[model samples]
Target: MRDPYIFSRMHRIPGYLDPGDALILRALLGHQNASGYRGGAAEIGIYYGRSFFLIERQLRTDERALAIDLFDAGDQKSGRKRLESFTERARDMGCVLSEGQVIRADSRTLAPEDIIARIGRVRMFSIDGGHGLAHVRADADLAAATLSPEGVIVFDDFCNPEWPEVTAAILDFLRANWDRLRPFAVSQKKLYIAHTGIGAEYGAALDRAEGLRRLPRAPVNLFGHTALRVSHRLWQRIGYEILCRMGLGRMSAMLY
Candidate 1:
């Protein structure tokens, strides 16, 4: 069996992930091997630090994490600044970052070579970066190039209309790279992976797509693995409206 560099303590984190996600996480942790792999994890976007805290709880001193984000301002500069501040405020709650853990940058420049020079090949790569076709495709390519054999690459906000490009690019990538990649888990909004396990998602291709669509929304795993990684604030606003009506509005939001 291949090693799966799993984290033991991350299951107890308070936000984002659900019981199902914890179960999946445990499976990842219980598969570690003595191979020379460092087996790391990352989050492309850290909006409020909830997911960062979760990852930090399971991280070792030697294991590195690359948190890619702008942190200052995007379309909603005020919101971005507030989120950046809130993330810093939540540091004391759990998995605190001291220094060098956070990389304040966009995912576009996060090339495969950067992974080599900075974080090395990872065991789990959580992508909540930009949702545009260009950004998602770039991250997918980077993950495809640098992910370890037994590693997992989870995409946040996989099939949202706001990021139509994300859905398009990922579906296209998975179809083309089915031999090396596979989709193992799907909630309502986010899609999880086990690599190679995705097999030929044939006979179940529509099922696969529909399954990915049915994944629990980000308010569930946004803090764990599946992020509400949308690039458009307009769509986010609408989603928030529905979530508010559904009573999931007042929470910390399982943001990526």
Candidate 2:
């Protein structure tokens, strides 16, 4: 399938997310749509609105997105600026600022109650804030408490060498909440998780997609459940870039 959204707009929103990851997001959201799931989307760390906008694009008209971040503070000055830029860009893309919320706060301090009060259970929540172990633990806890039964939680930077603490914290959380959640897929930049009972369905859905199954996969003991780690190799990454420029990034899944 050709993804006009990513090819024509995704790159314009600056962030660390790869195009392949965006494809996975699309697939996951598509599954939710097919299953008739309805809930808000959320992101703990929205640098500008790159991934946030991508998530927003998938939301139904009634669904909203919640963006939590430390905007306009200390080293996040650039982030604050980008956030403003994203607002304008989003407007240009036909999104209303009022459709979602942009909260400027340290996510570690936000209680689960605070989140639920603002936006009920979220169908898709991304934890990408503060790479510290403590921060990751707190974010994970909040995400868990506010996740919908059929929802998915995405942990960013898992296994990334630059943020080794994130991996440790995530594994710890998984071990502690194994009965509550289980990982189904791990991409180059994120790990996809869901309620344990629902994880198998997601895993099967992803595995059945010819595009997704083509990615490199490895067996992983995610806390306790067996899972697949799907990621791009060096050559695949280069090929993805080329395909994206060719406006065929969505089809790059076959390259694997």
Q: Best TM-score goes to which candidate?
A: 2
Model 1 spans > 4 angstroms off: 1-27, 30-38, 74-87, 94-99, 197-256
Q: Residue by residue across 105-210, what tens digits does model 2's lDDT show?
A: 8998888777777678899999998999999999999999899999999999998999999999999998898778889988878999999788888877776665
Checking candidate 2 for backbone clashes, the offending pairs are: none
Predict model 1's lDDT versus the native: 0.54
* Cα distance off (Å), candidate 2, residue 21: 1.1
After superposing candidate 2 on the true structure, give the runs of residues whose Cα lies further than 4 Å from its correct spot: 73-80, 210-219, 242-256
Q: Could you give candidate 1's per-residue lDDT for residues 1-256 as a string of tens digits?
A: 1111112222222234432343233334333322233566677766664455445445566776667777765425354464456454556454455445667777777677777566667777777778888888888888777786667677776767777888888887777776667675554455666566432231133232221232232323422332232122344445544554565543313221
TM-score of each: 0.61, 0.87
True lDDT of residue 87, candidate 1: 51
Q: Which 10-residue window in model 2 sums to the lowest lDDT?
A: 73-82
